[model samples]
Target: MQLDSQLDSETGNELLRQAWVQFSGAESYTDYCQYWLELMCTRIGGVTMATLVLDSGENGFLPSAIWPEKSQPDEEFTALIEEGIEEASGLVHSLASGSYGVAFPIRLDDELAGVVALSLNVPHIVLPEVMEQIQWGSAWIELLVRRQRGKEQTEQFDRLSGAVDLLAAVLSEARFQPSALRFVNELAAAYGCDRVSFGLTKSRQTEVTALSHSAQFGKKMNLIRRLSGVMDEAILQRGVISYNAAATDESQLVMREHAQFSQSGGNANILTIPLHSGDDYFGAVTLERPVGQAFDEQEQGRICSIVALSSEVLRNKQNQDSSWYQHLYRSTKTQLQRLFGAGYLGRKLILTSIALVCLFFTFATGTYRVAADSVLEGEVRRAVVAPFEGYLDDAQVKAGDRVSAGQEMSRLDDRDLTLEKLGYLSEGAKLQRQYEEAVANRDRAEAKILQAQLEQNLAQLNLIESQLQRTRLKAPFDGLVVSGDLSQRLGSAVEQGEVLFEVAPLERYRVILWIDEHRMADIDNGQQGRLILNSLPEQSFAFSVSQVTPVTEARDGGNYFRVEAQLQDISPGLRPGMEGVGKVEIDDRRLIWIWSYPLIQWVKLKLWSWIP
Candidate 1:
């Protein structure tokens, strides 16, 4: 009896040691229960199958894990196990009524959580002690389940935290697409996925711009085209599609189409997630896994979070791009306006202020020229008055006629002058005949000498008479007859130096502006300006600083300086004495300081004078 007792104790201890090893080796609740069920089946000699069912309380017993002799359990068996927990125990008892089987309840911290069932194909004896061991093993499995769940939760939290960090980096940096793509690719690789693709929706069409991707199978081009074609529809729908462990029929088709396809590959799966910012669906991320390798809902949810963060980064980048473009556009427009004097930068107040500060001491002295309007007049224009007191006989030109130097404009009535010239010619002819006779006879030496002198005198008289016949008024140079209209003044005899006509050079012209002395301080030589003619209001002619007279003439209750601007390009119909207004550009300043600059200058000057 002692020897038998020792052997029983040794056997019991060994059995317990084997059971502990199996229970401790389990990595998760499912593995632990599977091992425990297998151990029970092994202990029962006639057992055919064993299974661990989780109790749903009011729902039923759901098949958690099983070990079968010939094949895996069928859907019918699984359904039976999923029946209500109270009914499940009865159903199993009835199924094994004539056979050898036992159903043990598994308790987790004193609450019945599940049932472990073992079926024997034939009747067999089960020791009471062995039943206790089975019960104890089931309890230990429950504890492992809870511990495994805690570890999974902890790991998931860490993964999500890392994803959040990546998102923060993407949003903060300027160029984030590359970094985002790299991070996503790393995620795909970690999950053992074959390929990863990222796309963004285009505005005008059902297309997308492929942002980034990992390896593309041989059908990469075709896949890209197809994805791009469906982008609009996907964005509008904002849905996700996941294929876990591809169907056998579909796998065949995929293998034929994809170049990198393998038959022995892990479970083929595809997951797509939409990235959104507010109401806008930016795009989607696609993850591809090989056969037998797939992601669960938890993994998919984590990927969705990453997609959402990437969308925000893309939105910010687009906004930055738009802002930069707007700034560049405005800067370019301002520069062009400055280059071509077309807009407000060509205003008068700004230009005049600029000229004064640079060209004159008015800004320093607190005194500036005032502005005025006056009829433009020039000192260079001189009236071409009649030189000799005579009538404007035979007026050949009108008031507006253009003439050249030495061109006859009119002829004087020289009838009396012609008669005097004829008499002188007749006397010269008589003296020439007498001198010829004395020379031919060679008589009286003194008479011959006198005849020779008379011939010389007659020759001089003829030359003088010819010149008197050619006296007709002519233009001195190419000019316009501006002043006296010979048509109205014809035959009107006037004293010498009396104004008959005024002529001015055709091309030469100036703008004689009556710049107020207050503003004249800025007007100086070499300042640029623009002239707007009253006659030609539509045209603005360019001119530059030619002369700024120092003396100010009193006009319109103010001292005004005569500013003369030289025209650069002469327009049609421009002549001397044409009326026009001109703006002289002195300097350029910031748009903000135009009005205050003059006041500031005045105040500074006053302060300086007071201090001195």
Candidate 2:
């Protein structure tokens, strides 16, 4: 019997612990109170419980939420609620239905929050421990209400900050129309509103830009017209208009349109804010929430601030997206007004600076030069070639190497030629001995044939000797080896008449200027120019145009004409293939013309083509 009693006590303690835990985690005050009543009925053998929160607006307690929502409060428990509410302190009352009841005055620092009433189904079961536990649970009622209120306030702040940040971010990234659409959708979701719509006023008429929960909505829809009508009312009043919900202070204008719309739309709260920049009323935004959750003063202020911030962005973006001609005309008119009329000092200073620059360019004069790409080349280029088909025996020089008149550039093997020469000589000697023997034997015909054979053999020997002597390649003049590199190939075979190296004389050089085809018409044979080599950038070399090739070459996406020029001063160190910029002196002209010629020419060509 003692063990059974101890077990029951442990079970009851555990039940109370769970009940306290559930009470602390409630999301809202009404939800927590309703949940607590249900917990008491099941755990403490209560017949029924009721939760009533005082409605400050009506000056009485009203039921917010009830658990086992279908359950009705017994008359006995209901009767005690009014008595409990009247008392500023806790009350425990018993009814004639053999039901014992208890009530607690839930307070947060002396302010009554609500009343929690519970009645025991079995009066005899209301032990001292049971009553104490019920009171223990009631202690959390004030704390739960405070926690929920603070959490909601915190959430409100977070939502406000997030809405502003999102507005700035999306507006800065997108143009007018898209930014407005995105802003309305995000704003509605943040404030827990059922619908959000944005409208812009142009020509004294409001046009809907976007509506939340709908991507492509028509402005002529009945619902849109109603929503837009609300915004129009707000704009006419030049202040915020709210309906189906309490405002901080009511505006003088009547909200008849909103009343009709809300009645048809099922008890929705609507707040419309008109946006303005200076004298221009740009647009407005309408936020709509359901009956239970209405727009309060704090949210109204937030919406107004957000609309004010976003109005400038939308206005500027609309101006930017105007037609090009309209923009130009408006800008010209504004500028004319500013120049003749009063304007900011900064604008006047900028205009003055621009005018001064224009005057300077129009009247200034200086020498103008038509520039082109140029490369240095030898006046006379010499090519070294193989005398005959032979294997390369040795190479002593490559490209860019200096060589004297008699210096060996490369050599071909002479062993094969020497062997052929020896064989021819041996044949000739044998033929001569045969011819002498024929003459001693008085054989004139045979002697003559042998003599001709010997002559043929001697000629063959001469040919081979010539070939062997030509195998050693030597420079013909004192000059640098401009091109060719055979150092990597020692025993490679070369074909006859093949070019092996190119040598340019040290004393003379020419410049090849690749002038653009368009500027080539201005170039003549005698035009003088100066070249500054990329390697020798410190000095410029003067040259006279010697020749202009009639051929046109296309390279690097442009047509070029090859114009050759002879250098007036030749440097020994100046090698062929040295490239630089060459500027040909054209006749003098105005500084503006020289600077604007390319642009003017381009415009002329475009106009000529377009006119045709």
| lDDT of every predicted structure (CA atoms) | 0.61, 0.78
lDDT of 2 at 358: 91
For all candidates, what are the clash counts? 24, 0
Question: Using lDDT as the measure, which candidate wins?
Answer: 2
Q: In candidate 2, what are the lDDT values of residues 1-612, reduced to their tens digit?
A: 999999988987887778677766876656677677767655765555555544343566776545456667767767677777788567766667666677766677777777766665564555565657656766666666677678768867865687578667657655777776777777887788888888888667788887877879877878888877777888888888877654443567778777777877734688888888755576888888887787777778777777777667766777887899989987997688678777567888898999999999999887788899888888888998999999999889999889998789999989999888888888888888899999999999998899889888878888898898788888988888999888887799999999998988887898988989878778888888889999999988899999999877898999998888889987756888899999998777899999998999899989999995
Lowest summed lDDT across 10 adjacent residues in model 1 is found at: 252-261
Tens-digit per-residue lDDT, 1-612, candidate 1: 999999987886776568568866877666777677666665544566677777544675566678863357544444444452444333334352455455666767666677766555653344444457666676666766566657778867866785777666555556545555555665565566676666665554433333345432343565565554334344555666565545434321222212222233322566666667655566766667766666777777777766665666765665465567776885786566565645555565577788776655433433222233533333355465555555556777756778888788776556666776677677767777776787677767856676776777677666656544444767767888876666766666767667666667767666677886656667778777677777877987777767877767876676788767677767657766677677777675543355556688789889999995
- Sliding window of 10 residues with minimal summed lDDT for model 2: 48-57
* TM-score versus the correct structure, for each prediction: 0.35, 0.46
Residue runs of model 2 more than 4 Å from their true location after superposition: 1-345, 431-451
Clashes of 2: 0
